[model samples]
Target: MSAVGPLDAALTVPAPAVVEPGAYARLRELVAGGGAVALTGAGMSTASGIPDYRGPDGTRRVQPMQHGEFVGSAAARQRYWARAYVGWTRFASARPNPAHRAVADLERLGLVRHVITQNVDGLHQQAGSHRVLELHGTLDRVVCLDCGEVTTRDQVQEWLADANPGFLVAVDATSPVRPDGDVALPEAQVQAFRPPLCLVCGRDRLKPDVVFFGGSVDKGVVERAYTFVEQARVLLVLGSSLQVMSGYRFVRRAAREGIPVAVVTRGGTRGDAETTVGVDALVGDVLPALVADLRG
Candidate 1:
């Protein structure tokens, strides 16, 4: 959810191509294995007042931040924090959409085993899905890379509000909310702004607890995800385009091992070749109906 500038034109293009129209039955059959592991992405959160980086058509709407830029460049850090400060309220206000609720309901019905989400929004958890593994860290929290101090993102926003009064209204007046709790603002505003630092240590780096683009997810987290996939009888991928290899690698591995893989997304996915069933439909529409049918 963090990007500094316009993405290269290559990255901005989307690849959403709707497949055949029978995703509901295909998804049902895939989850019939009774131990399906759910893999989710940004598209899952679009209905919860969040804008996805890639639209339903699979085109990129925003270029995400690279890890090196946030950790290494002071100016990048300031700009990111400035936008995030303004966008925090918008991000915070997002509630779990029906898609999120349906996922949670499936777990309650003993149909889903675990949820592995690429998004950092924590909306799945908010929607009441338990045993969830966030592949990327969450926006709701912050971590001090220096001292390992963990605090709520709200705390940092409060600090930023005190330091940068009138900041949000100034930049937010023009910028719209972007996915990943980000906003697009002018460089002049960013340069004039001051970013937050580690409050506990008084001098060090503080970043949202998310795994940035080009950053590696923690090994322990990756290992745990593999373990879940190993125990799973089937893999159910939802809403992701699988453009990122971190999430796509699991699908590739599952396919190699002959595990049942079903995908329900609105656009073309890099893993379509590997999917046993590919559904081209809106998750919000498909999931709620599926959940209702499951309950009935």
Candidate 2:
């Protein structure tokens, strides 16, 4: 994958209402045929009760944990597991919403060919999207950095429960949850929490199977996503700010290849200028309406 910034050229559509008729019409027309790929982000899961990293205005609400820090500092790992252990309960319970269903419906209608998501949450697959690719990896698994053995996150949770009895009960549930599926906690609580060890290696280097900030996605995965976009007629982006280059690169690729790019998201996106049609709205609301319009 290549490192990049914002695109120099853009289509510059005006930001529309929550469900602008004109923008919706253009979106419907673009995806009317099969061969569109849906690239999603945190905003897609917000309807399922999961919060995003940024607000509607596009300002970041919290600083995410970096990969370097998590790998280099033992203290960082301890704090991460503590917050994650508590936050997992809520994150795991998040259900797929209307937008997810609509995207699945698009696939069933043979409009959308594949889904490439920046979200680590597995809601797309849960929503019945068979051709789904995870760009950043999923949180449902754990990897041992020492032995390189992979294990289920459920097993790690069990180990954490055993090591830190009553830890969850002590944590304040109101603490803000981050986009990475962890919550904020006091330093004292974070310090008191004991991190889980890898079952295979019996080492303390168990990390969630996710790409943290400052982490690189696997080359194979990036290549696959590129191929999907390269073959697509339209690149339909849902609920993503496209702030980071990971997802933004696909948008750039679509634009460069003359594939029409449509963005449906709340607030502004870094790829707004590059979009063929830009709709500033909730995807949950827009997608269902689009599905209804297409059916009609």
Candidate 3:
């Protein structure tokens, strides 16, 4: 395959699929024959009460904790755990929304063959999408950096509660939780909190089983995502701006392979130039309509 030009270079970028009746029909036609792969991001879960890192304009709303900062400094880890512990309940309580369910429906009807998601929330699986590849590891598990032992997030939450009694009650519950399950808190509160230790090794080196910002995904998982895109009849982007290259690369690959690329998102994305069709609408509405039209 020939190398596609850079996103900003002089190229024939498709006109933005501004929200219109025709855009929906065009989207339906693209995925109507099935064999599409859904590449999802944080917007896919926004309807489930989880806030994405960016806004509709593709601007960053909150900065996430970088992997190096979390791993290299004990103080940083303490701050993270303090916030995460406070935000855990809200994050864990989020459920799959209509958009997620529609994706599952598409899979059930054989419209979507695979799902490659940048989200760590595991909403796809909860929505009944069986062939999901979580490019970023899920937040339900904890890994020990020192001993390489694994444990569940629920167990770690219990350990944290035992280690710091009445800590959760003291924090301001009104503070909004970030998509990564972090909440802002006073410095004093963070200092008073304690991080969870590994269940197997009993050391204070446990981290959530997720790829933090500035972290590389596991190579094997990336390869699998690439393989899926390569074989897909169409690449369907749901709710992602594709600003980050991790998800955008797959769009690039699909475009290079001459596969149809359709984007159903709320705002502008980095992959506009390569898209075969772009739908600027809420995924919650578009997906269900697409599924209905195709199913009929």
List candidate 3 segments past 4 Å from native.
Answer: 1-18
Model 2 Cα lDDT, one tens digit per residue, 1-296: 11112223332333235667677667766877668999999999998988888898889888998999999999999999999999998888888999999999888888889999999989999999999999999999999889999988888888899999998889898986678888988999999998988767788989999999999999999999999999998999999999989999999999999999999998889998799998888998788877765655
> Model 3, residue 50: what's the lDDT?
92
Candidate 1 residue lDDT tens string, 61-152: 79887899988987788878988888889889999999999899888878889999999888999999998999998999999878889999
The pairs that clash in candidate 3 are: none
User: Measured by TM-score, how close is model 1 to the native structure?
Assistant: 0.90
lDDT of 3 by residue, 1-296 (tens): 12121233221323224457557656766776678899999989999999999999999999998999999999998999999999999999999999999999989887789999999998899999999999999999999999999889999899999999999889888999898898999999999998887767778878999999899999999999999999998999999999999999999999999999999998899999998888888898778766665554
Per-model CA lDDT versus the true structure: 0.81, 0.87, 0.87
> Residue-pair clashes per candidate, as listed?
4, 1, 0
Point out the worst 10-residue segment of candidate 1 by lDDT: 1-10
Candidate 3 displacement at residue 129 in angstroms? 1.0
Residue 244, candidate 3: Cα error in Å is 0.6
Question: Candidate 2: where are CA atoms >4 Å away?
Answer: 1-17
